[model samples]
Target: MDWRTKLLNPKQKARQDYKSLVTPVYRGSTVVFDEQSLIKDDWKQSENGYSYGLYGTPTALELGARICDIEGAKHTFIVPGGQSAIALVYFAFCKSGSHALVPHSAYGPNKAMAEGLLRDLGIEVESYDPLIGKDIKKLIRKNTSLIWCESPGSVTMEIQDVPAIVKAAHEKGVPVALDNTYAAGVLFDAFKYGVDVSIQALTKYIGGHSDILLGSVSVRDDSVYNVIGSIYMQLGLAVSPDDCSLALRGLQTLAIRLEQLEKATFQIALKLSEIDIIENVYHPALTSCPGHEIWKRDFTGSASVFSFTFAKKISGDQVEKFINSLNIFKIGLSWGGVTSLAVVYPDLVRPNKDFEGRLVRLNIGLEATNDLINDLEIAISKIN
Candidate 1:
């Protein structure tokens, strides 16, 4: 063989038995089989064995498996990001002429997809109140195929009655999908509450450091798994194994991070509630949040993200001034990292109420509770 032939050889000369506490990043596009008869492409790699890297490399599968174990799902699929997970579920369950129900308070991008891509595809996704609960049955039509719930919903922080919604959907043979990112899959037992499909933006909590973009779709049973898996393969939603490796590392510290974040956030929320200028603090653990009792019943714990509203007398411009005044709490979006963040929704929309730009959402990080409170206090003083 020529020197070029030796350089291109696939054989491993070094000992391959190295073991480590961390998952190694597996990067490759092709999978080799000893026999041509064994060559095939399948997405059920967990059962059928690895046939192609497009399905997922071992590192991605391992992250999915760990999420499955924590969320108590039958199977889990890893995708590029949370929005991708939402897209996968939408494509899997809702087809042309199919009707679906989604909370108006769902992640912003989720609603955007419903109105944009899903609408253009001939699928109609109707928005419902996050507090609809068992009354959701009233909205189901003969063509209804899917229902979506997002507990402690994006920005507004409404904790939904998921079990009631699940029961209502199941009676009509419709499936329920949840955006379980806020709970980080572990805080809320999605499968236990009868949620058919539970999806998360691992970019937030499971990534823990906000450095990686990843998502997971976990199913309650094999029937749901097959439905999602088929679409997953067709869409070719490939993820970086390097991101998976980071998420795998994130899992190791998730419990401790959640513990600290919960404490710090709850403390800050309590302090905010006492301020006369703050009309509401929408943390799921507090009674000010819609469906607080449901959150206590369904979730094991509360997470870092929550929203608050300024007094009606305060204008949107003042809210922006307050946000800019903060020293430690950075102005940004997304949550569940080590850095605290604040953002104001000047144009937030719901069914009957108008925020008038007084609504602000905060993501509490692992910073000192007192320090965070002081940051908010100083900002509030500046605005006044």
Candidate 2:
């Protein structure tokens, strides 16, 4: 019962090789070593070994492993949020005087970063047409360092020809990175289509609960992984073990969730397209969307997120009224959760694109199909 005895507990206490269904949440800054020589001066955030807490804990590594498995990537690294994953790819491979070709329809913040951060750093971040496909080769220069794509591009729902773009980039010795958040790495195959780096906003689909903020970078080649991981470590990007555990749990149900989402979303998109209130629907599987053939050819399935347009004559006030009337679909930013979200982007990225009127994006979640449709119908009726 002495205090000395209590303080003398051995660091290597054996729990008789206990096993559990879930990866253990290891929360600690200091990893104790048995001997001094075991600790190396030059440590790395590697799959085979442990370095420091800022690099990653076992729990985070496990989540990374799960993502890499789904993505068919050779290595995976976790970041604080989805944008960090995007920025990681940029900071990793790009330097002053280099150029990055990004899809015009990519996530809005990514566009902002390209303009603000990358541009200021002397890297020319050019917005390439999402449907450019192999034509991207023409835009590539000797200083080209990266190509970024977002399938069924955020809000607008234009499907990029990822494979063709990848082919073009690789032939020019440039690496390509994609924001796979919409597909959630389930409906689409990034690596199979020759994407160099796959970035997932784990905050959306992977968290599935709208409670966690995390992101992951999955790479097929070790050299690519090393370039990304080294910058990842130097930047001191570390995710909470608790958040990583939540993401891991989200992985367990991702398949079924995606299946239900695809089914419900397609039906809703079909109904929306036919409605008199809608000007156009932008679902990749739907004919109204651009690059439908490319989507059908490369993607394994569809996702719940899509967008639609109202008649150009419709006033902004009317649009606001319709959205405010919705009960089931809440006004929010970000998608891929159990609850549906409705958001409207006033200014289109390329206002000249074949779009008319106000654009509204919908993230169809795990709600009853009839109820969600009814909510939309009632709101549309009010607007009319």
Strongest candidate by TM-score: 1
Candidate 1 C-alpha RMSD relative to the actual structure:
0.9
Give me candidate 2's TM-score against the actual structure.
0.95
lDDT (Cα, tens digit) per residue for candidate 1, span 61-90: 999999999999999999999999999999
lDDT of 2 by residue, 145-223 (tens): 9999999888887888888898989999999999999889868899999999999999998899899999999997979
Model 2: residues with Cα > 4 Å off, grouped in runs: 1-16, 41-48, 354-357
TM-score of 1: 0.99
Cα deviation of 258 in candidate 1 (Å)? 0.2
Deviation of model 1 at 272, angstroms: 0.5
Candidate 1 — what's its lDDT? 0.94
